[model samples]
Target: GFLSGRQENVLRDLRRQMTQAAEELRFERAARLRDQIMAVEQVLERQKVISARMVDQDVIAFVREDGSAAVQMFYIRGGKLIGQNHFVLEGAGEDADACEAVQEFVKQYYQTAAEIPQEVLLPCDIAEASIVQAWLRSRRGSKVEITVPVRGDKRRLVEMAQENALHALEQMRAEMRARLSNADRALRELAEALRLPEPPRRIECYDISNFQSEAFVGSMVVCENGEMAKSEYRRFRIRMHQDHPDDPRMIREVVSRRLSAGLEGEARFTKMPDLILVDGGQGQVSAAAAALDELGLAIPVCGLAKRFELLILPDEPEPVALPRNSQALYLVQRIRDEAHRFANAYRILLQGKKQTRSALLEVPGIGPTRARALIRKFGSVARMREATLEELAECPGMNRKAAEALYQYFRDAEVREEA
Candidate 1:
C-alpha cells in the first residue's frame, strides 16, 4: 500500500542507491541498505489475502523438543496475512507442556509488543485464556477475543503456524550443530596434549556436592563433540556415609556404580565414556582409576583442580598443565563447570525435600507416610503449606483429622510469623 501510495518508486530507488553505493566503494553502507531491501521484500512475499472480519488478529502456535521451543506468530491485518515472526525459548520443557510454553510466550511477548490486536487465535487451549484476554482488552482499551478453533479455516491457519514453528526449531538446532562443527580442533588439541590413542569423542565429567557431610551427591555430565549431551547425564546419591563424606571415596563409588551398570547392559548406561574427568586433584583421579581397574576397564582418567587449573592424571604424580588459553583446557573446564552445576541442582532438590519432610513431620498426626503423600500430591512444600483444610482432606490417603492438624499447624505458624 505504501508503494502504491506517493512513494511508489521508494523500493526501486532504494535498490538503485545500493548499487550506486557499491560502485562508489561505499561497501558498508551498501550492505546495510541491502539488508533493509531484503527485509521489505520478505514482508511483501509473506502477504496473502484471507477471509476474516474487519478486526485485526494474531495467530500463535508453537512446537517444543528437547527442552527448547519455537513460537510462530501470524499477523492478520484487514483480512490479509501481512507477515509473521518466530521466537525461540530455551529450557521450555517438552511437547506435553505445549500449552504452558505458549502461555509463557504470550505473557512475555505482549509485554514488549508495540500493539495488541483485536483478536488472537491459539492452536491449543490454555488455562489462562480468561486472564490473558482481560489483560489484552485492557491494553487495547476495548473488547478482545481469544479463540482456539476446533475446525475449519482458522484451524488450518493454526496448523500451518505450528508446522512453520517446528521447521524453525529444527533449523535453529541444525545451525547450532554447524557452529559446533569446529569442535574437531579442540578434540585434536586435547588428544595431543594428553597423548591419547585418539580424540575423546565422549568425555564424561564428575563432581560431588554436599553440605558439611549430609546429602552427598555425585553428578556425571557428558560432552560429545564439544556440546553438552544432557540426556546422558546421571546423578548418584552416595550410599556410603554422608555424616562425614570422603570426597575421594564418594567419587570412587559413583564411578564404580556407573561402570558396573554399563557392564551389566543397563538400558540408559550401556555406553561407557571414552574419558573420565573428576573435579579434584590427584586423589580423585586415583580413585576413578581404581574403579576402572577393579572392573577390568581401561578408560582414561584425569582430574581438573579448581585452583590454578591443573590437570592431574592417574599415572602421573606431577600435575600436567596445558596452555593458559588452549581450547583443550577450555573444553575440560566447561565440562567440569557443567558437572558442578548438575551436582548442585541435585543437592538443592534433596535439600528442599529434606526441609519439606522436616516441616511436615513436626505437625501432629502427620508421619512419614502422610508427609510423602502430601509431597506427591502437592509437588512442593509451599503448595502444601497453602492448602486449606478441605483441600488437604481431599488429598489421597489423608483423613479429616490429619488435614485439620496440618491446617491448624500452618495457621498458627503464620500467626507467629506475623507477630
Candidate 2:
C-alpha cells in the first residue's frame, strides 16, 4: 500500500518534471518538483523489505558514553532490514543506566508512531515492559510482544543495532576532533602571517550597514580559533553618526563603545578579541586603532579592503597580501562576511519595522502613539491583521471606534490583494 500502481507512475512523472525544470532554469518550479520527488522517495524507503517472513518488527539498542547516549533503531519486515536511524541524547547524565534510557525512549518513541510493530526487541529488560506491551497491543488492536533476545538471529540483530549506535557516537567524536584541529591550524597560520606573538584564539570583525543614512547599524561577529562564535556576535545602532554618515567616524564610535564595555567588564564584551578586523581599508583601520589607543588597550587590529582583499594594518603603508588559497585569508574572509551579513540583516529588520509602523499609521484614527502601542501589542502588522475586533479593542489605547477602523483597513487591503 506504500506505493500504488498509479502513485508510482505519478512519482516517475514528477521526477522527470523536476529534472526538466532544473535544466530550464526554473528554480522555484524545480524546487517544488524536487519536494514532490522526496515525498515519494520517503514512502518507498519506508516500504523496503526487511524480512522474508514479512513480520514487522523494531530492534532497539543504545550506547551511553561521556555524559551522552546514542540510540539506534532498526526497522525490519519480511526478514530484511528496511531502515535504521540513530539519535543522540545530550545530558543523559552519568547515573542513568542503559535499561532506563531504553525504557524512556520506548515510551516516547511509540507515542507518535503511526504503526506499532508486532514485536520490539530491546538491548536489555526494562521495568515498564509489561505496560509498554499492553499499550502497543491496544494501539495495534492485536497481540504485541516486547522481548530481550539472549541468543539466536534476533539477538544478533540487537547486537548489530548496538554496534551501529556506538559507531555513530565514534563518528561524532571524530568530527569534533577534526573541527578542533582545523581551527587550531587556521589560527596558527593567521598569527604567523600577521607576526603576532601567538595565535589569536578569539577574533572580532566589525562592519557597518546603511542605505544613504537610513537604518544605519554596525555588527560585530566573533571567531574563536577560526570557528564562528555566534553567541558573542553583537549589533549596535549608529546613534552618533545617524545624521552625518561618515564610515570612519561610525567605525570610531562602534569601536569606542565596544572597548568601553570591555574595560567595564560587561558580560558580553568582558573578553577582548585577540585581533579586531574592520571591513574597510586604511581609514577604517586607523579609526578603530585610534579608538583602541584612546582606551589604552593594545589589541591588534587590521582592515580587509573589499575591492582588493588587502589586509591593511595600523600605521603600515603597504597592505599584507597572503596567498589566494591561504587558510589565514579564508578565516579573515569568513569573519568579515559574517559581520556584513549580520549588519545587513539588522538593517533589513529595522526597515521592516519602519514600514510596518508607517502602514499602521496610515489607518484612520491611529496616530503614532496608538500605532506604537499596536506594534508593541501585536508584534507585526500581519498578526495585527489576524486579530479580532475584540482583541484589538482590548489593547491599551484602543477604543471600539479605532479598533473597528483598523480592522476594516486590513480587511480592505486583503480584498485588494485578492483582486
Candidate 3:
C-alpha cells in the first residue's frame, strides 16, 4: 500500500515543515510543499478503498406502543476521502442511549470493516425518518443512506393513518359538493319537512301581537333562499276586533288582506308567496289557509307550533322534527321570530299612543271627536305646543274663546309635566 509507515512518516514531516514556513510568512515555499503533502495523503486514502467499500447494509427495527418499523443504510465506495461518512439507521429514539448506540456501531464497524462481516441489525425505538436524519447530521458525517420501511406491526400503524386520511378526504369532498348543489333542492327538502307541495322558494310568515287583543297588529315577513327578504316585509293594523284576541281570526284577516293586495298588483306586495307560515298551531294555520282559498289562491300553508318548536304541516300525521343544527330549521325559525318581533313592536307603538290620547280626550271640554280633530290638525302633541291661539281656533268646531282657554291649559300642563 502507498500508505506504508515509511511514506506516511515522510508526509507528516513535510506537513510540519510547511507549517513552520507559513509561520515565517514563506508564501512561495509553503505553497509548494503543501501540494507535495496533499499528494502523499491522497495516495494513503487510495490504499484504504477496500476498507471503505466493504460496509455491511445495516438494518434497524423499531418498536413503540403503536407498532414496529425498520430502516436500512449502506456505505459508499470510491471517493476523495478527508473524513469518514456516517448514516443514521432510522427507527431510533431521541434519547442519549440511542445516540451512543449508533456511535458505537459506527466505530466498531469501521474498525473491523476490512473483515467484510455480515450486516448488523439493531433495535430502534423510534420510526420517524426526520428524527433519524437529524441525529446523523449532528455527527458531521456523510456518505450514508437512511430508510424506514413499513412491515409487520409497522404496517398496521401506517394502514390506520392511510384509512383516516382517506376518510378526511371524503368528508372535504362532500362539503364542496353541498355548496354546488341547487338552492331549490335544499328548499325542497325543507318543504318536505313541512309537508308542502314541492319546495317553497318564496315564503311569507305572519304573526299577530297585542295586549289582550286591544291594540292588535300583525306583521308579514318574506323569506327567499332560506333567508329574510327584509325589503318585502309588511305591517298591518288590525281594524277588525279590539276585544277578543282570537289569533285564528286575526290570521285570516291578515292573510286575506295580504293576498288581496298582492293580487291587485300593489307596488309593494305584487309578488305572490309560495307558502304561508303562521306563528301558531293548526287552528291558526287553518284560518289562514281558508282565507287563501277564499281568495282563489292555491298557496300551501304551515304553522310553527310554539310547544316543542315543532313544524305543523297540514294533513300530516305528526309534526316534522328537524335537527337543531340544520340550516332549514334555522331559516324557518328566523322568519317566525322576526315576524313576531315586528308585530309586537307595532302593537306597542299603537298602544302607547292610545294610552296617551285616550286620557287627554276624556277631559270635559275635549271628547274623543274633538281629540281626534285636534290630533289631525296638530299632527302631534309636541307640534301642538308650537300652535298659536288663533291656529287652535282655526281647528274644526273650536270657538275663539274655547281655543284660547284650551291652549292655555295645555301650556300649563306641559310645564307641570316637564317639571
Best-performing candidate as measured by lDDT:
2
Model 3 per-residue lDDT tens digits across residues 1-419: 34355886788789788755543334346668967875675556545433334543344322222222122222223322322222333444443355355445545444544522233323433344355445444443543444333466334333433343344345334433443243445476687776666778789999999886488899999987654678988999887885888889989999999899888988888888888889999889889988987989888888988877788776667877777655566567767888998898889877767765785574557767777788778767767668898898899977776677778878888899999
Tens-digit lDDT track for model 2 on 286-376?
9999999999989999999989898999999999997876667767877888899999999998888888989888888999989889988
Name model 1 segments beyond 4 Å from true: 1-178, 394-397
After superposing candidate 3 on the true structure, give the runs of residues whose Cα lies further than 4 Å from its correct spot. 1-189, 195-199, 363-365, 376-379, 386-402
- How far off is residue 28 in model 1, in Å? 30
Point out the higher-scoring one by lDDT: 1 or 2.
2
Ranking by TM-score: 2, 1, 3
**Model 1 — TM-score against the truth?**
0.63
- Name the candidate, 1 or 3, with the larger TM-score value: 1
**Cα lDDT of all candidates, in order?**
0.84, 0.85, 0.65
Return whichever of 2 and 3 wins on TM-score.
Answer: 2
- What's the lDDT for residue 54 in model 1? 63
- For model 3, what is the error of residue 55's alpha carbon versus the real structure, in angstroms, after optimal superposition? 75
Clashes of 2: 9
